[model samples]
Target: MLLEKLRAEVLEANLELVRRGLVLYTFGNASGVDREQGLVVIKPSGVDYDDLRPEHMVVTDLNGKIVEGNLNPSSDLDTHTLLYREFPAIGAVVHTHSEYATSWAQAGLDIPALGTTHADYFYGPIPCTEPLTDEAIGGRYVHETGVAIVKRFAGIDPMAVPACLVAGHAPFVWGKTPDDAAHNAVVLEAVARMAIRTVQLNSLAGVSQSLLDRHYFRKHGANATYGQKS
Candidate 1:
């Protein structure tokens, strides 16, 4: 039953990516981990959202091998698996070629922390990893993608920053579950859009450190608790 719930959540979140206009055709995918089952439920590779169904979601082990499914898992599975292995607390991951974020990635620019909306979720900027060399990009590319993200932000706190752009690629986000990860994807795209607009107005302008500190602390700091308490 728990596995079924995770599968359902993963399917629904994939559709939400389409609903938000964050993806074009079959450009994005979402996945949820069933930790007890030691498997991940993810969108099938190259499948259009209109054709996506609960049964179409593939089940795979942490190694990216399909454990159960008629279709193939997303090509980005290895990247997702690496993250899960490195961070047991993350139960969900989302990868999207969302327009605004991809624009920043194409330019090799980081998404600046621009407002309370951006700061509340990510304490600082959404980092864009340095471009991978041809050798690294050619071998075990997905795994190397994960390595780049970790190596780029080696000293930062992961929870405070849930997403990163893969240099010339798109954005990858992780959360406690696929639902949370999808939420981060949407938020990331929104902030990216804002940042792009802000740059148009004035490239030198950015969110003040004091405001970033206040917003992030009130929502995600040691003493912070969002939503209603249990």
Candidate 2:
């Protein structure tokens, strides 16, 4: 029952993925961090979505030490841990092999911000990390996946974008909370689907920087005007 609230939120976020069709047969996982406690709660590896409950969430420290969980953490624990360490601002992380996002990753291309929907969530095209080198893949790969993502964001703001497609793999997304990360994952898949169809109709069509700026800033930044003010 440790971190009962966090365990519940993480559980709900995982269920949200299934509800949104963002994951299949437990193919994805989500985690939330209690920043003050420096601990994480994540789904157990290989557990079916239908069978998951709050206590099923495994708790681990920032370094991946088990603090309260009886089951093993998700297979991607290292990646989530590394991200938490490297990107201090994020409170949650979500990984999903969602159809369209994974398609973009498989194709080794960025999902261009060709319209406003994408701009609303991401400040720019969703970047795809360079494919993992054979050596990196062979050595500490789960952790190396995070290394590649961190490397890709050298000059970019993780909050501004909030998601990255792992080349030839899937998308990893994070946000200020578990719910927010789940929201981004859902948005990323929607935009990815739209981007695919757009290229099919006209490969040259693209969103202008000015339009991208207008849409993005309306929902973000100090001057954000989207929705009512908090």
Candidate 3:
């Protein structure tokens, strides 16, 4: 148990995705990084949720090398690791083919900040990455997935948005901890579902920058006041 607590947190986050209906069958995975020890604990690849336990969580180094565990790490380990390396502020990552978000991704559309519900979590539009080039796809598809995501956030603060929807794929969400990542995943799905309906009602619908800034900053900005003081 190299990362005993991180293993349990990763397990719980994976289970949370299933419970929240963000993942289907064995289609998605969740992982947590212990920044200090430079280790990651992730859900075992393709394993059924019902069969998972803390021990089944695999431990790997930052480069995706297995340090402990009998099972293979999630296939998206490289993407998770890249995010950990690039976005040092994040503590955990969760990837899911959540229906609404995936729909936007498949359409190669950004989920717009159509209302406060979306602005409350995502500061602006939830971005969709540019599709991977054929060369990147052929060479190292999984690792390149992370490259596209990082490219999309070139000038943005990853902490401000905390999520990215990969073009023609699905969404990857992260936060300060495994539970926080899971929570953000659930919110991402909710807003995405709402965005679809909002668009149908009015294609011109969108929140103004002033309102977007107000809602986003109220909760996530330096002087956040949405919830009671921590």
Clashes of each: 0, 0, 0
Worst 10 residues of 3 by lDDT: 221-230
lDDT by residue (tens digit), candidate 1, 1-230: 23677788999899989899989989989999988878988899999899887888899998888888889899989888888888777889999999999999889998989889999899898999999999998898988998888887787666789998999998998888788999999999999999999989998988899999888988875677666766
Instruction: Tell me how far the alpha carbon of residue 136 in candidate 3 is from the true structure, in angstroms, after superposition.
Output: 1.5
How far out, in Å, is residue 143 in model 1? 2.1
**Candidates' TM-scores?**
0.94, 0.98, 0.98
Assess candidate 1 and give its TM-score to the true structure.
0.94
Ordered list by TM-score, greatest first: 2, 3, 1
1 against 2, candidate with superior lDDT: 2
Best by lDDT: 2
- The sequence of per-residue lDDT tens digits that candidate 3 reaches over residues 1-230 is 68888888999999999999999899999999998899999999999999999999999999999999999989999999999999999999999999999999999998888988888888888899998889988998999999999999998889889999999999999999999999999999999999999899999998999999898889986788898985
- After superposition, which runs of candidate 2 have C-alpha atoms over 4 Å from their true positions? none
lDDT of each: 0.88, 0.95, 0.94
Report clash pairs, candidate 3: none
**81-178 per-residue lDDT for model 2 (tens digits):** 99999999999999999999999999989889899999899999899999999999999999999999999998989999999999999999999999
